[model samples]
Target: MGVVEALVGATVFDGETRRHGVAVLVTDGRIAAVLPEHAVPAGAVVTDLGGGLLTAGFIDAQVNGGGGVMLNDGPTADAMAAIARAHRPYGTTALLPTLITDTPAATAAAIAAAIEAAPTRPGVIGLHLEGPHLAPARRGAHVAELMRPLTEADADQLVAATEAIGVLMVTVAVEQAPPRLIRRLADGGVVVSLGHTDATYDDVVRAVDAGARGATHLFNAMSPLGHRAPGMAGAALDAGSLWCGLIADGHHVHPATLGIAIRGKRGPGRCFLVTDAMSTVGTEGTTFLLNGRTARRENGRLTLDDGTLAGADIDMAASVRLLVERVGVDADEALRMASAWPADYLGIAEMRGRIRAGLQADLVHLSDRLEVKATWIAGERDEA
Candidate 1:
């Protein structure tokens, strides 16, 4: 048997439900078991979490930048590692280093960096290319000039990327990427998502039929849910197979609006929280560059000079807290949105999203108030 350690003194939520007086056993960087505290095996090392809640670490799929490093600014393995480190303190154990609306060459560089980093960087799971193939009408902070239709060559490149990285997610407008192309990418193992579009309800349904798995930051860059015209937002809420990424920063979406969406969201694919964080997270910097334009961070919002929202100024822990406190979400469900739901959306739930036996020992310990006190990735404590 490998070296065994028992984590105790906290209420445990094993992704599905909560249990008290249980000790989580870790061996060889995987969960060994979750049994009663007194049932801990003989000679196993013990560490008390000091009265808190232990749950699976948060998994974010829409992280743009962190640790003063933007993936677009530095599409290298080191930058990806830096971004992961920046978010770890905030309870994010794994994240996709997102590249937003950059050139084709830049996208290639980001993919190469992700392939290079995935083996060594446990936190950098994959890459999220969130544009250049999006609609100019809803280009929030993306360079409109760089936005273009998805070509066969672009589709080929994205499909090829899926073979190299653990996950390759591409966000495109339905108008630019037709159902056929979406089907091709999905068949090639890419997690196709809809965003930055003026697409109609029919457009979204066609994409979903073509295997588009999710909506990027629902109701922000996509078309709104109108009573007469049910746009992408309407389709997202109505579609049972599509996971919606919610930016619960209280700026991109209102608390009440998020509450209603949470309550009305369809099944099999619920709304999950994503940070959409920028380089300002875990830093004191008040401003950063988004495609060469200045994005100012003030009043808990990140926006361009023209007042266009750039990305989010929040972290995963704060996002969960916002949903629970402001949006009136149950604490357990909000925690699921931050961890389990995103892991399921990324198809990585079998690996690290839960505290079940045989899963990776990725965990976060939070105070009764939901603030992160410490985190463990692969059974190792994050001292940074």
Candidate 2:
């Protein structure tokens, strides 16, 4: 019953196919219709986008900071808002504010902040707790001294947090969190993901059985695939039910390996793109601190002084470009990896990540060169 606006002329990629000369009608923050250009209502406010490509906005499952602000700096609603505002122009309309390995107090603060911020922050889909519970041997960029096993108390707190905050994703090492704890978190509606692990294939299989449905930044902090062993990396590729998040920056994963992951993974579940981005993403800074150590950004990659990979400097638009121009993924599939697949992985596909009637009108408009022209979150243009 609210105002209806039509987005016209651009090619609309509706999460499945790209259609030409169509108009997307949005009413009351939801998609009201998708029709031929000629069918747009006579009185509807129309925004013609020339020949740009309009698709679902990118959804990043891991974002630490942006706009010179890191989540670890404040762990407050204002900090979350700053991060969201900073990334909105880069084509990310929704994201999980990731808290990397930190003290228990810091973790709790981040959780509380995300819960408080989600209702007010349009781009904040949820929070991703990347660890305190992880394998120290595989804890890349995380403080080794802070790594610990998941306790019953920890599990209980997570369950309660999930109840308070919808779409809570916890990335843990399978070798650390017992199968029972994994099941408990999953049953309580927490997305349990395997990450920072050196677990063997068998260990990963057991974790999968207990509802660990995803892997965080595959092949980076985890054990690599061996010819005979097929460690955590191999298990992630082999597990048909598991979704793997890939950093498509061409540094974290080579294009050849990215191609293999795209071709080899059996799905219902598929490999999707995640920024695993840090404070340097949408800002001018070339350095930031992670757990009291400085991570320098150089040559489009973030690394510690010791040269361990920290996070990434890539944004959603750049990742899509890499997939299309370098990795040879079709443009539509590349867009889906940045948008729809992440939505599906987060279990929010029905309401977002697609262009359809009754779905939230979250869209990104891209120029022919694949650069971000503009983005809309829930039908409102982000002016940032």
Candidate 3:
């Protein structure tokens, strides 16, 4: 490969709601310049994309597993690889391996495995432990038997491992997860998200007040925003400043509800997309393995045999497509939910999220019909 590749005629987006004519210059795996079409760098090996739609590399903040490999399956490298290859094709260039509520030993093993795998697999940004430190009252699919208090030792261990991880996200309830533990995790550079809780408005405020950064799978695992109660979801929406992730598969959250969030959290940094998919994503069949239990995917949704909603069968790229097709949203605005927003939420805003100068040349090229034609991860372009 050349030192730089000038992508000519491609309409590049900065992972924000702005579209313009630009030729991207990538060098050493970073965006060196976003030049006007007329200003292609001399001898830059110009690649005329025929004006394909170029957006930032997709980020799925909440990915369970894909490719028939569950990351929660003992945190082994094979499991992580299964998770990576599963989403990589559907335009998920980066992701967080989500582990559900489990025993302390299991949680620790997951963390260690995530840390070990993250470095080798750059697309695996970090680990998202969705439970063990959550509210049982709102535990949607997590095993209730394994839920527990937010122990300091657990926080310390996750933090210590994060010294090696680029990011670490934990979904917890302010009422269930200890306050100081959340604060400490945030202070130590771990991203704290509130979810699976029946927290009151004040409780939501306190979590944010205590330095929680975002909400995981908004409107699915948290309390609804009832006018009379306006509980945790209400507080999150009302706060109006925190970053929230929505599973916009049109299954987990309705387009109308997503529209309401789009209006409510409209100011600066508000909402994004996450595919809370379990292990069955990107597979041809319906059955999957979750916590070693039989899981099923029916009608584009994943559920336990008892018809309990486990997670999702959607990927982040498909989520963007759903937003455009279902919500009638602007493509740029909708794309932010998967790329820029999640990057900023993880505190890797400078590098991972946007298609701009000096940012990583991680991007996706799609056809007019929104089909992902190619995905570039760490500068290695994969056309599929």
TM-score of each: 0.99, 0.98, 0.95
Provide C-alpha RMSD values for all models, in order. 0.9, 1.0, 1.7
Residue-level error in angstroms, candidate 1, position 280: 0.3
TM-score of 2: 0.98
Clash list (residue pairs), candidate 3: 272-337, 273-337
Candidate 1 Cα misplacement greater than 4 A, ranges: none
Give one digit per residue, the lDDT tens place, for model 2 in 1-384.
889999998999999999999999999999999999899988899989889899998999999888888887678888888888888998999998889889999999998998898878889877999998999999888888999999999999999988667789999998789999999999989999999999999999999999998999989999899999999999999999999999999999999899899888879889999998888877789889888889898999899999999888888889999999998999999999999999999999998899999999899999997899899998998643
Two-way lDDT contest, 2 vs 3, winner: 2
lDDT, candidate 2, equals 0.91
Number of the top-ranking candidate, with lDDT as the measure: 1
Off by over 4 Å in 2: none
lDDT-based ranking: 1, 2, 3
Candidate 2 lDDT for residue 294? 90
Clashes of 1: 0
lDDT winner between 1 and 2, please give it: 1
What lDDT tens digits, residue by residue, belong to model 3 across residues 1-384?
Answer: 457788867677777545577788888888888878788866787788786688898888888888877766767755776787778877888888988888788777887777788888857878888988888788787887788888878788878877786778988877777677888998888899999988888888888878888888888877888879988778777775568889887878889999888778834657888899877777787787776678787788878777778888888778888889988878888878788888878888888889888888888888877778888888888885
TM-score of 1: 0.99
